[model samples]
Target: MEQHVQKQPDSPVPFFLWRHLNTVRRLVLLLVFCLLILLPYISLYQNFVAGHAYDLLTPHERRIYDVMEWLTAPIARSDPANNLNMIKGNTWSGTLFGLKLSDPLAVVGQVAAQFKLYWPFLLTALLPVGLTLLLGRFYCGWICPATLLYEINDAVRHRLVRLGILAQGRRMDLRLKYGVLAVGVGLSTALGTVVFSAIYPPLIVGREIQYWVTANGVGAGTTFFLLTLLFDLLVARRGFCRYLCPGGALYALLGRYRLVRIQRLVNRCNDCTLCDKVCPFALRPMRDAFGQECNNCTACMAVCPPRALTFRLRIQDQPDQGPGHQGPAHRRAAVRVTAKGEVA
Candidate 1:
């Protein structure tokens, strides 16, 4: 007779979408972000009109909209009634610049004069505030290209760690991001302008691509694009996210106060240890589900056969008794019995 041994279930799609360090998924998102830069490269017409299609007035929304507009460019089309190469106003260039400065390195490009007018600033602030009130950082998880880049990096780095090439995971290095935030804000204040947005990733990729097209032509842009792609693919995960991105760092700080949380059950846990194995962020959910590192991906909950974990609005709401919270010694004993039963 064959004995049955249970294994952990795969992580959920959302977790896989952004948090899973799986190479295939990371490749898909990376391609998507690259395609975003390729939008204006293809057509001056689509670049002019649809270029700002997603560029809402809010800082975060404009950033996300620009990224989406760029990524979806291959399929974007204009009506034949609108000529492909008609003269467009300077407004288009302005929109392009507004989009580029959002990058951290400003490697892509910069354009501040076009969209930084007072009206646009009002619009930028409203969007993030409104969304934060309604959704609680969905922008960080679902939209922001910077976050997407980091996720891709996270996936790659995790693989490197698994292979023992990297000794430990990348941390935001707490002080580093804070220092960046301080300097960026301080400079913006001293300069009497919102200059920090210039280095943000969305703007960075946008500007770099645009500059490459104008100065060195497509070859330069293509070269850097390929280089970044290679780094993302072969390197440790999220080379950019862990070490470089300030916008993502801002979101992580805001995310620390997020009301929605993934929680663990202590008593009912069989100590099968599936959650720890499945977590891609190198977090020990067994020790603390609310660890600051958790991005709320829910991989642990998905794999728990006993349904030991969940996303709860409040940690206090948890039933006060669940399988995930048991002490380590208790868990070890439980697993030993499970092993013995299987052996017998």
Candidate 2:
């Protein structure tokens, strides 16, 4: 809660790999997105393998069976059911290598819906909650399939803005997501359903990917997701995630005092505003204003030409550090100070 430095501290050199984390993060996002698409097909294959019904299947079914058989031949040939059971479900709630992990918001939404606790189900979310406590909304940055699409949408937004097809994305109050979370919780309580699973972009994206992959006609979620893309394109850049996601609100609350956060290195910063420009969460890393909303996506760090940003083990962001030492304002100030000294 109390974060301040009376004077700028000397720099601690960041490791070379710190900047590469965004690339690693993109790879992780793609891997997770692929897994979301792959797991459904795997489940479909598992059903056929478990039934031993290859001969009974239709031509299309047999082709799926053939491809899945070849794909899973290495590890799951013996017992696709048991062997492939190592991974199941989507990001909302999934078992991986015998460990079940779930979205924290999933648990919250369920509790609101059922009005009773299922301890076994609740336990599944602990790993993610624990990670969020330390990592501060890392799920949004590193794992959420929706985020990958949102960023692509953001890129498209930039293009459209340049072409005068759209204006710069409108900035709304960040607190709006908290209101969304409250309303969603209330609605779940009243409706007795985990309503967020339908609206939450990550869950929606995974569900849609599965449908399209499994050759099930895409669901209503596709239409909703497409609207979100348009919302980001026309209304705001990442409008839903920034202003309306309940899951994001929950993570922001949980990770309010996240132990590991990105800190600005005043010495290296040139106040060029690149970090501010690239931040997905719209955090002001250039002004040391990274708050709970920062997902530690490191797009800011990656875009830092001076390599000014780095991660630190701290509970809060440093107070504003003023203009970077390399900036024009600081240079002008320095010149004025030197002249005053000579005059004195």
Candidate 3:
């Protein structure tokens, strides 16, 4: 006799939206990376034309250059001195909707340089830090160009693992990144410069890409960025981001009181461990719901077969319901889980 099987219901709209959002998020990151590479070349070409290279340009090239310059004008700085040295006409800093987008670490270094805190630097730092308070390390997961490279390396590693050519790498202590941050801050304070920028992967990659695009050669930081890629590929998956990224450590600290978090339905979880396996940061969403280490990537939510996970906004003092409850009834669950995976 033939047996009949029951099919499970489809996931809720939020889950479906989350799956598509992940794809959109990746596309956005790729677009940002491409823009970073292209902006420098555009600036270089415009500068060359302004310096009499215009006579050598084809009509079509001239039109393209004019259009690009106009398009990038709002975000691009006009003063050469204000731009990044490598990308002379391309600005490293800009305002987005009147909000400053400068690096907080750079701001800290500036304050250390003067041996006094400046209100302007503090105000500039607040823009990114305030966003982090709402989004929770979203920059690491959604925008950082180095994260794009890390994700590529991670994908390659996963393929190798499936083909029996690589092993599942061990997860390092999350505190290592904090320790690295402390050391970097100490060095920057002592040296009175942005010491972290010299080796920071994102900044290195940006400078290198700008150099390559404009000068047709790699920059001083290229070697450091490439070494970071190698470390991610062979030494440990996401080694730089997880344990050595001072910038990430700063974000984690800034995002400590993030309003949004990943919520888990304990009753739905069957302990399949798929969510844990898919997390690039090695976050165990099933066992440690809403952990601060979570970058809010939602990869776990997308991979969860039972639709047990979803992003939610909750107060810091909310109770943690161990694994089974769902919704408003579970609002007062036990204490929330800390970054160390301990019940707080």
Task: Give the top-scoring candidate (lDDT).
Answer: 2
Tens-place lDDT digits, model 3, residues 217-252: 786688788788888877778888988888888888
RMSD of candidate 1 to true structure, Å: 10.5
RMSD of 3: 8.6
Sort every candidate by lDDT, greatest first.
Answer: 2, 3, 1
Task: Compare candidates 1 and 2 on lDDT and give the better one.
Answer: 2
lDDT string for model 2 (155-181, tens) is: 988988999989988899999999999
**CA RMSD, predictions in order:** 10.5, 5.0, 8.6
TM-score (C-alpha) between model 2 and the true structure: 0.92
lDDT of 3 at 167: 76
lDDT (Cα) of model 2: 0.87
What is the lDDT, from 0 to 100, of the residue 228 in candidate 2? Answer: 86
TM-score of each: 0.54, 0.92, 0.77
Q: Residue 274 of candidate 3: its Cα lDDT?
A: 80
Q: Order of all candidates by TM-score, from best down to worst? A: 2, 3, 1
Top model number, TM-score: 2
lDDT of 1 by residue, 168-195 (tens): 6334454465567667666665665555
